[model samples]
Target: MARNKFDVDENLEVQFNFGHLKRMMGYVKPYKKEMIITLVLMIIANAAGLLSPYLMKEAIDSKIPQSDKMGLVVLSLIILATLVISGVCMKFRIRTMARVGQCVLENIRRDLFVHLQKLPFTYYDSRPHGKILVRVVNYVNSLSDLLSNGLINLITDFISLFIALGFMLAINVKLTLISMIGIPVLFAVILALKNVQRKAFQALSNKQSNMNAYIHESITGIKVTQSFAREDKNLDIFREVSGEYRSSWMKAVAIQFLIWPSVENISTLTIALVYIAGVYSLDKTITVGVLVAFIGYIGRFWMPIINIGNFYNAIITAMSYLERIFETLDEVPEVADMPGAVEMPEIKGDVEFKDVHFKYDDDKEILKGINQRIKAGSTIALVGPTGAGKTTVINLLSRFYDVSSGEVYIDGIDVREVTLSSLRKQMGVMLQDTFLFSGTVLDNIRYGKLDATDEEVIAAAKAVRAHEFIMELPQGYNTEVNERGTRLSVGQRQLISFARALLADPKILILDEATSSIDTKTEITLQKGLETLLKGRTSFIIAHRLSTIKNADKILYIKDGIITEEGSHEELMAKGGDYNHLYNSQFIMLKAV
Candidate 1:
């Protein structure tokens, strides 16, 4: 069993990309009407907020001093009416923005998922499932607030600040100027802390991705852990990973907490200065009521500043999420159709490799100048030692990773020349490691053909010799297969996968050790099924058991990325080449066992 490496020491580098923000905002285009309506409501709410202080000024200066009960009642009523209007506008604005935000979020997540699906297999090979999951799920979720409330709150806060500042300057310019001195200081402090806060959030996001990767790997290999009695060891590893995640989160929280206190202190000091100025103005041109109202407006100004600071924090955090999301979005698929790539018609399954050269890295070649041709409807068995490029051949045929040089052709059309979907839709692949989703046996088999009927699924199961065992289950075909088909025995999972492949009825079928898990009896039955299934389809079988290829139309003995020998099993055995050595060695091993 492999132990997960618990290293959280990687530097979390990220950009607060303005271009990504612009691209993200593009999702809001569909909801423009909702956005405009929400903005209008926000403006109305801010306008009401703006009028309150003026109403207070009027009551204190005109009505209360004159003992004018009617005027006081009118002003009081106007204030109360403004409060209700503001409350109503705020409530409606929140609802509208939330609706728009959720719609935008849905669009983003949909695009993320669809784009991920479209990405080439190479992209997946290079990244962890956990990291991708975090970007698709948690990171996108983080943007929900920024898209909805953060945006609306940002707009309203600025509007409130400007309107309140206008009133403050109007009431007493000197006092307003005195109060505004702290504004630059607050901004300077925020700017100084921006990078630190961003780094903290980036660390937190990275830690989250790391923790997810560890958990996913651990759970997937839980069987091995339990079998080896390594649960305590894995738990210790999990604790280390979880601790790193918590520490990163706290670092972000610490940065966030730092901002509020700093802003509050500056605002408090500014308020004291405003009070001093107000007191001196009492004997001057400013009235007591105007001074009081100015203080109210000053308080209003600082609150928005505080809110904007918080929004700024949110923006920085949201920017980190966008950075990660766009990073994945920016990845160009390694194997994508060329411009105007034609959709392949029904394939005749004539596979040809013309000088195919491939390497996952420049340092070492996995396949070297490979050349071969298979007639339509012929079965080609690839017998090779491990790491001898058998799987790479099948991968090339499927166009999962394009050959570094040269071409793979199907029915005289270059695999790269055809649209991937049109080409891949006609091929079926089964691997040694069977993977079944968490669903019914019927559902898993139907995955090969989503529109397959229940009857058709049963027919496929019967064709692959899985029908008997499936019927023994409590729900028959409806019996749920737990994740990775853990609820089923290894042989049973392979049989279901065979059923899945058989249902697809592809023109080309690639089986890489497809029967490795099957017992001898199941393999015997499967061989009988394969005799019919391989009749018209072009099949590529990568098998370690030499006996399995004895009846193959042709067997290619591959070694060190080269086909050293190719012939029927009987002919290769007579030739006494590398294939003969491999066969006899395997035969002797079987006899000894």
Candidate 2:
């Protein structure tokens, strides 16, 4: 339970791993052609930039000294042309890489969402949904720059560094060697900060996820918070969570801020050293023009180093996000179709549970060695106190979770041996908490069967007695509702869910407290429609209302993970056991009312 808290860090110690970078290359593969073009543009831009310093050296050393005005004019024009070429290439490179980045973002986000759909309920139950959402949205977004621009920049910066170094060495060996004195110092500084920077960014990622999780939870539970007057308490929690995020962000940015100044300072010191050395060594052999050009080359040489340092910073941050993104991607679905699993044949509504035993996450068993069988087209009522395993039985029947032991057979075929989609498509399950997506009333009903016609939707709504209330709305069946149908009454939401279930026309129907929210008058009206809906179908109805289950073909009174009594309403009354007491208690309460 602690692990499910919004503030809990899902992962705390994410080591800097190159394997994440290697995995990112997979997303980059599809955009290889676009990236290659961007790389070519980058190389052209760098080459053009490199020519500017050399052209200046030529104008200073050869053209100006001889007073050759035409040569100087030509050199100026050549320098101007290189700047224009470099700028144009940079513009195209940036534009091309941005497109590639967006594509990579889309691909990664699509894969993550697809994987999320495959995960079982347990995966969601064990963690804060906000944490999961952050990985899908925030972490995936973080990788866009790294995949699109960072890789190319890392490569081109090295190329640029080598090209500038070669030119410097060509100008004069001694000054080039002197200019490179800062390299070892820079490497040492970066290496010393590497582990610290990675850890800081990892902490920041965790904090960001924690804050996001809290925000999502808060927003989702705002009604309850206000009802219970928990606004102040929730606000305090938010403040604490957001404060931690801000602190972590500042720490990470502080570490990142150190890199640029260090590189700039080192570059400045190296240039000063080159200038002092060239001044003393100035002679016929090494001209002033050569000295100035070599100094310019020194600036070019360190610029790539600075860029590489920035890219390194980006990689560290991206790795932190990648760790979480890949972690989610790697999560194997707890429930999946078996290899070679066949599609379920059309269901005939025969369900049998043979000595089923189940537990959730190693906790005490929720279902214990239960055995039951129901004939086709029969209605079974399950009555139990809360936590008495009534819902677990239906969950097993639907293959929501595999039984710890024994088998659930549908139409004499093992449920596990069939494809999940085919098996689930043949059944309709209406849970206690009815959730409606944001859509029109007609669309919500049609959700149960995507290909359902508008007339079919209307008929289902009428059969479930939802049509009258729906018709009262401003647009009748076309009336729009927000998420979860929050604007509608609880009873209205359940009625819409019933219409959805009926629209599916499933052979097997499981209604867990389906009418618990409806008023007695509404429930009486719905019963008629339910009778029509249940004809020729096997159904399992779970409700505490004795009136609802009194007519079921079989009544099961469940307790302590086992069925304590089973019979029709009259038979259970004659037995005078647990079911008798439960029924009489409800009867007495109604009499008192």
Clashes of each: 0, 0
lDDT of each: 0.86, 0.89
Candidate 2 per-residue lDDT over residues 355-429, each given as its tens digit: 999998879999898999999999999998999999999998888888999999999999999999999999999
Pairs clashing within candidate 2: none
lDDT at residue 234 of model 2 (Cα atoms): 88
lDDT of 1 by residue, 165-258 (tens): 8898887899889889998999899999999998889888888888887887788788899999999998898898899999989989899888
The list of candidate 2 runs beyond 4 A from truth reads 12-16
Residue 33 of model 2: what lDDT?
Answer: 90
Q: For candidate 2, report its TM-score.
A: 0.96
Looking at candidate 2, the ten consecutive residues that score lowest on lDDT are 8-17
What does candidate 2 score in Cα RMSD to the true structure? 1.7
